[model samples]
Target: MRIATGGIAQETNTFQREPTTLADFERPGFGVVARGEEILDLEGTGTVYGGVVAEAKALGVELVPTTYGGVMPGGRVARSAFDTLRDEILVALRAALPVDGVLLVLHGAMALEDHDDGEGLLLDAVRDLVGPDVPIVAPLDLHTNLSDAMMAGADAFVGYKEYPHVDMPRTGARALQILAATVRGQARPVMAHARLPLIAPNQSMVTTWQSPLKIAIDRAREIEREPGVLAATVLGGFPFADVPFAGVATIVVTDDDPPLARRLADELATICWDRRAEFAVRPVPVDDAIAEAMAAPPGSVYVLADIADSGASGTAGDGTVILAGLIAAGARSAAVAQIMDREAVAACIAAGVGSTVTLAIGGRHDNLHGPPVRVTGAVRSIHEGGFALAGPMGAGTRSSRGRTVVLEIGGPGGIEVQLTEVRGHPHDLNYFRAFGIEPTERRILVLKSAAHFRAAFEPIATKVIEVDAPGISSANLANFDYRALRRPIHPLDAGARWSPGA
Candidate 1:
């Protein structure tokens, strides 16, 4: 049996001003440029494609890779860019017709300039071409905005349980294995979905350990191992997408048993909605977080999570609120990865290493986060800006920060500020390690991330605090002017309540 597989993935943050283009996908970050059998090179490496190849090899099925290209989470994709990627996948799949099954690696929250339900549209087109007899299984990211069109088109779905998504390869293996079984007539997978009217912040959704989301996901896994159950998935959903389906979702698949699927899906759905309050947490105020960080004991690494300026959520990554507070409070032994200031980095490069350079750091993108501050510092190091993920999330992928530099500001174990040409978040500690900076050596490690950083920085950190700085991706959802999101949603609409709608 041959299973066609490939996907175009992007998390569209409508609140972000920048527009994700085809050129962005060709950049050194997240974009993997391989097509057809050339994609087989990813077999033994890290990624969903690697798992697909491994599973197919073991299952004795030919894994026909159509194409795979995904960019970092960013603004709404241009319609032209979306069609180019989607059409390429479609054309490849058409050429590899008469496949027994199909497996897709998709991020469910994507949106285009013209199509709000980007994945839904893609799935609908694929379903039309393949027909209903061909079972389709899609592995989705944990932060997905699952829609009705997705449930209608795909036969089964699986999503990452961990927020950092360390289980990506495992999730891909599971999807392909399930499809392999279904194709061999050993299993008949039937799926049921339940969409909760709750949308919560991503800060508390880490599934590596016990939390509200973990509790529910753990319970779902327990039920998934039952005799008739095939798989269970809970998506916390991406709220910044400003789509109608931007809320919590649950999907349960069973071996030819719709009732079992429905029952398990409802059970997990109730668990998520029951702990709605826990998911709607508020970030600690910036000033409060700063004071606490300043007063921390020596030899401690406090991970100050700057959620607002998180480049992972498509923010420009040049916000100055947290850095300004840290400097003003006379905090020492601090290191921050990155405030994306192209001009600042260029000036430092021209000034040469060890030269005292006076430049305005951060806040260069927009006024949402605060204006730039003049910082007089010596250039510590400069690198061309490329690193591999030694972290839990996307661990083996090669990533780029684009012409990065380290500048020493303030005095006494001075603040090391990493500046980048691109607006990429310091999700992994390797970003600092690439420049010979040790993160554990610093008293305060400031990361521009919401929760993804915890996977890497948590091990070395003495404490972790989320800051409510003003920006597009702030933990405080009220900060955004959301126009398309369905109202009466949790947190955004505090008094809102929900249950499975008939």
Candidate 2:
């Protein structure tokens, strides 16, 4: 049996300042943009693409090559770039005709310039090319925004079960397993969805495997043990995407049973919604959080999570509200993981390490994440940033910070800020250790991530306090002027109500 696979993946934040372009995908820093059997090289690793390879090889099936392009989290993908990659995947699939099945790897929450339903649009195009007979299965990010059109196009969908998404490879493996079963005429997979009017804040969507989400996922797993059920997926939609389909969703795939799939999906979605309040979060104000960090006990580190400027959520990593507050409160033994400002890094490099410099770092991108704070500091160190991941979040993966500088702000504040040439989320401790700074030894470690940092920094943190700073990915969705989201959604609209469609 032969299976064709490859795709373009990106989680679009419509509000982000920078436009996602073709160049971004070609050199994504962390991973290479692959083509042809080049996709085979990505297999059997920790990534989702690797899992797809594992399954095909295990089944001893021929895996056809297709192009794959992915970009980091940012604004709506430029139509030209989207077209270039979309056409590449479609054309490749068209040329690979006569395959037994197809496996698509996509970030389900993607939004292109004209089409907000990116995965749905891509799936529709693939379906049209392949016709109705070819069994198509895809594994999606847990942060997928489910759409009706997407459901119409694909035979089944496999969504990641973990946040920080350690389960990517397993999800991909599962997708191929189903595709193989279908090819052998063993299991007829029928997919159904129970959509919810919920856009959960990233902070509340933690799957320590013990939250309300855990209860729903556990029940779904239990149901998967049933004879007819194939898979059940609960996706916490990305709120940064201002689209009608952007909301929490439950997808269930059953073997030759539509009614059972719908029923299980409905049950899973209801359980998640009933515990919706547990997902609501109120962040501590920046000034207060800074003050608390200052007063923290000796030998303790306060993990200050500045989620508003979360690089993972497609926000510029130049937020200064928390840093400004820390300076005003005269902080000590503090270090902020990163501020992405190429200009600032260049200025520091020009000044040279160990030289005293008066610099205004950050706030160059936009006004949403606060203005650049003026600090007179000495350049502590400089490096061409590259680090290897330790685990939980992209374990064993390599990430780059580009050209980086550590600024040791003078005076009583004693704040150290890391400035990078590029904007990448600080999900792992490598962001700090790679630059010669010890994260655990610091008094206050400011992380520009939501829940992902918890994978590495949580265990050692005396207390983790989320700060409600200013940025595109703010926890308070009400802060943004939303134009495209469907009216009266949860948390946004207090009286919002929803029931699954029949």
Poorest lDDT segment (10 consecutive residues) of candidate 1: 493-502
lDDT, candidate 1, 1-502, per-residue tens = 9999888788888888788898888887646656788667777555777677887888899988898778888899898888888788899999999899989779888999877888998898889989999999999988899899999989889898887777788888999999999999999999998888787777767775677888999998898889999899998888777888897899999999998898889889999989987886578887898788778788888988898877887787898988888778877888988888899989999999989998888887778878998888889899999888778777667889899899988754879899888887777889789988899899888899878888888889899998888777776776667778887777778667766643
Q: Which stretches in model 2 have alpha-carbon errors above 4 Å?
A: 28-31, 411-413, 500-502
Which lDDT tens digits does candidate 2 get at residues 402-493? 89999998543388899998788877778888888888888999998877788778787898898988888787877778788987888788
Candidate-wise lDDT, in order:
0.84, 0.85
The local lDDT score (0 to 100) that residue 400 gets in candidate 2 is: 79
Give the Å error, residue 443, model 2: 1.6
Worst lDDT run of 10 residues, candidate 2, spans 24-33
**Model 2, clash count?**
0
